[model samples]
Target: MFPFKMSEGNPNDGPTPQPANPTSPCPCRDDTKGTQRYETKEQEADSAQESCYSLFTVTQKRWIVFLVAAAGMFSPMSSFIYYPAINSIASGLNTSVELINLTITSYMAVSGVVPTVVGNAADGLGRRPIYILTMLIYLVANIGLALQNSFPALLVLRMVQSAGSSGTISLGYGVISDITTPAERGSYVGLLLLGPNVAPPLGPIVGGVVSSKLGKLLDSDYASVARTHGLEVNRVFGDDLRNFPIEKARLRSVFYIIMGASLSILAYGWLLCFHVHFSAPLVMQFIIGATSTAIFTILGALLTDINSSASSTAAASANVIRCALAATGLAVVETMVQKIGPGWCFTIFSGITAAMGPLLLLERERGLGWRNKIYQGNGGSG
Candidate 1:
């Protein structure tokens, strides 16, 4: 499979041999290929094998991975932790359960959007500064939540908490681009997500939300290879990031993943009918957690692979779509259950998810052609 085509060889493979004809003219300046103008996927793969460099020592990388993974615990922790207390919060605020659920909905909706600003800033600014800023916000939000009395205060504080936490996922991916090469990235990313995946089931019982810069080009072997390729580190793919079929490159690696997540969500929904059993729903939550984490982790890696540098912006774009869909689902789920009951309600959602399989098949077949046509329409800069 084309699978982002970033690299396909074993990690130990050597760099591509120097172009016999460096004087043969760079393919990059051509409107058709731009900087990503690889003569073949294997060539890019070889270059990747050669470029897998990192300044961090193995022990240091382990620490950094643990830190990023730990940061992932925040988003879900904030959400799941608050769920068990929903009733108590409603009682304290003298509000109905519906209004408290509105708070939940608001938290998720904000989670969907706040990443745009944080992630964009993380891309342009440095990941370290953004990380510190958001954590401070998270800290303050926690204090405010602890003191919150009114329903509005609770609502606002939850949103603030979401704002502080959600962007970390995007930034986590950006870091992945920095420390790991494509050949070994998937596993490292899985490690980075340990916090997120492990947090969900335990979160309601304890309650907590736990938990990016282009400077990366300076830190790893990618920088060396990018220099050799005559590509700009600031714009890794090129000036026009759209020149590559990025959607295809990313999704190409995760086709089965999309379907697997669909099945898991379907099962999760049906199990929600038995939420009173506690463990039953939590077990399904655990399964869905694993599947969803795989989807995010893989997609994040692919986005980093295709974009202009390994970017937080690219990763944030994926988060925007993912969180938005989730927020929409959360917003309407209660009404759907009341209207049609959980069985019919979730079956419809699952069906919608299943429908994507065929469409993705179509995307796999024609996405490149469609992108090419658009490329022509964009006057070759696409």
Candidate 2:
């Protein structure tokens, strides 16, 4: 069995204990998941000193998930909140709408890159400290955004805001993995995704509504002991962090879902770019949002599974793909649309996503072997 640091009870008893009554709650048992497999008896014995499940109770874990989801909202909220106000900011700065969009590109660019550092730190230094630090950074950036007068200030501060807000995602996944079991992970995934998926559609709507009225605004592990403490570990992902075929672990399950999202993006782009019926684009938005959310949810859960010990780092690396690709795309989208028009633009973007289907399928087939090879190389038995 893949060993998570589960409390096996009294060693003298010879078996993991069970709850006395079928109807009674089991200590440290919850509906979600996390785990690690150790190769040595000494290592396993060391792990046994920790909690059987998570350090936190079911109620505590649920609350942590909810809080993390709430925190996750800030990133999307800040980005979309500024959308409707773009024209106003542009006009006030005596700049073009295009330039205003650059601030967004900058925010996304920083959002993509900052997590590498934050994820590493969270895994090593512990989640609570990192959480408090990032939130403060984010809060200050938000305040600056609310008060900034120049485009430069806005651009710089948005990146600052992104730096603060983006790490929450990686952190949440780590926390989820800490408290959850793989078998029960999906249920918590929905809750974990509540902010990310729910925020986008609502973000712009919220942004549009709020910006129209006011303005813009928003790992794992060290699994064993960290799980027992209801926090992240005070260590890094180790020499093998970059060596694993993480791309395969992350994208394999989502290959078809990506294609679906690509199609959805294409359709949404067509509706928005062309003079389509109002509700048509709205419907496409829903479709695209749902599809994209599927990609995030699936990939997030899978990465957590693969990097059970260093889930935060895994989630952070995943963000690099999601945010970096988005930043790259956003950087060029307007220029592409200007040169080719919406239909062709959507076609190109959709094609970009669709092209991945083959690689991802290959990932699905060979990913396990690749991961095992990494483990074998590291003197670990998969």
Candidate 3:
């Protein structure tokens, strides 16, 4: 600077500053040594900050868990919603209540059994395809049930429906396990269980209202409209009514309505398979079934997450804790259903299920602290 600024020297010339020795600590360091150490400390601080930010971003993950949980709920909703409609079904099909009961039993049995088989398939084939296939089968079976007049046809279709619908539960849990970390698994799993737990009770309530109203409208006993339409009266009630000749116009109208609904559902199912948009009894059933399916899948996924995070010795213990929580939830739902009826059961369950979203935020905070402790321990060991 002196040479450049001085008038006697060349204007472009300047003294060069000496290079600092790489081994020498800067004067800025009070210790006057180990500058590399301070640099490393700064780097570590930056890394830690980045890690903290990454772990804190769990809101998206929680939403994924919720969706998967919702999908899992659909299976139970589809199966149980029709429970209240059984008598109407029996009447319409010219079948005994016992046969309808058998259908219900078969539906339940298949739902329970098929999931185990499909669970393996889900693991092999992956969640998306399995979910699409399951929903499609369900849609087809429902449509078939709506169209078919024969009891045997109904039974077979019902079986197929259960088989396709049941896979959702297990696969849903599998998806959850994929996304969530171990420390945060429990809360999501609990939320997943909440869907189906609520479905049984809510289904019957809606089913009862719809079935009763539909039965009334379809019945020959109604006064003004019955006479207006010139509908025939059968002396026998319920099954006996099926044997009576339904007016051609009335039968055609009913068939049209059923087929129309079935077609709409079929169209929607195709959309779902292709990941396209669709529209409420049809979409509602899918939603409920999907939610239930997702819940079970999330449960399994959360289990896997938990297993991965814990030590081998602690894995069994972790599983026990999870199972206990699940058992407790099941017991609570069972008790509630028994004490207050299925309608309230679902209401309470849904409330609890929805509540899990917030719980995930809390768990994430606690999980971060726990993970820090584990990290610290590992570092100390190293």
Candidate 4:
């Protein structure tokens, strides 16, 4: 409608030049509006650049995607990986666990802000440089963390570490968006999330091993220590879950998940405080890890059900809120433990978690069925 050519006018038509190749640059002027009609060669080439997925075969692409997702996980991994060393870190720094725990609050605070800036920069500067920059920041922070003996140094460096690490998962999502179509996006996202989901449990185990045997050996003999240590529900419901009542099927599961996770949290802190057994906390960590993963997965599905198109925004919003709450929780938890003692402090968190159950139940009662029906009627459109 904007621009059209007349059929090669009959033979009587004035002679016309051959049309230009679309790929080749051919600037044209519209004298009436004084506008240019073509782009430069470089711009055309940029427009023609291949997608991120085009460079690899199917198998290769999967591996690349998985690796990127795994790399993204390092940020979350760093958070928990240091957990087993919390007491050790406190003792080594000659600081209270309360003070050491504030590092977690600082970390989450910085994490909440870093990704917004990093994402905007990624849009402006490209992903590779930012990725490299963040990784260097994290690496340097870890080095400092290992060497520093003071609480303030620990606090400042953890923030720096989060600054470097938090945007990685967002970057992973960007990659999935670049390579995948909507039909396949859900699976890719699930796989990408696996990195974070699995890291919680494994982090503590690895952290424990490294800080204990490995750290001592490195400091002493330099050779004395060399050691290392190391989801099915969706299938049952499958696509059929979409046909069923979304709220009842999905959210009801969350009820159980929150219950289990809350209890695990309470138990973990109780066991540690009482010196029940070292393995007890580890076991609780594993349960919490698994339950938390399930909770997130289900919540994701619920959000998607509500509005698929806004799922990314929903996730980002949730992350920000979660980080903020985590910061608050972390800030208070240490002091709470000091004042009320660990047993009751954990009980309080357990109660907080239990509080969520009733809220979820309320949602289920209010309009869960109606909302699910609306979603279904809409053809699950985003």
Q: Which candidate is the best by TM-score?
A: 2
Clashing pairs in 4: none
- Decide which is better by TM-score, 1 or 4: 1
Please give the lDDT score at residue 345 for candidate 1. Answer: 86
Query: What ranking of all candidate models by lDDT puts the best one first?
Result: 2, 1, 4, 3
Alpha-carbon TM-score of each model against the true structure: 0.64, 0.69, 0.43, 0.54
Candidate 1 structure quality by residue, lDDT tens digits, 248-314: 4335545566676677667767777655676876666555554555555555554665543536787
Provide the overall lDDT of each model, using Cα atoms, as 2-decimal numbers.
0.67, 0.70, 0.54, 0.63
lDDT of 3 by residue, 351-380 (tens): 555555445444433543554566578883
**Top candidate (lDDT):** 2
| lDDT of each residue in 232-317, candidate 2, tens digit only | 32221222323334444335346666766788778877887778889887777666665666555656666776787888888888
Model 2 CA deviation exceeding 4 Å by range: 1-51, 91-99, 147-151, 203-256, 266-275
Q: Give candidate 3's error at residue 121 in angstroms.
A: 1.6
Q: Score residue 85 of candidate 3 by CA lDDT.
A: 93
Candidate 4 residue runs with Cα over 4 Å from true position = 1-61, 77-105, 117-161, 174-187, 197-252, 269-275, 301-313, 361-382
Report the C-alpha displacement of residue 23, candidate 1, in angstroms.
41
lDDT of 3: 0.54
Model 1, position 356: C-alpha lDDT score: 76
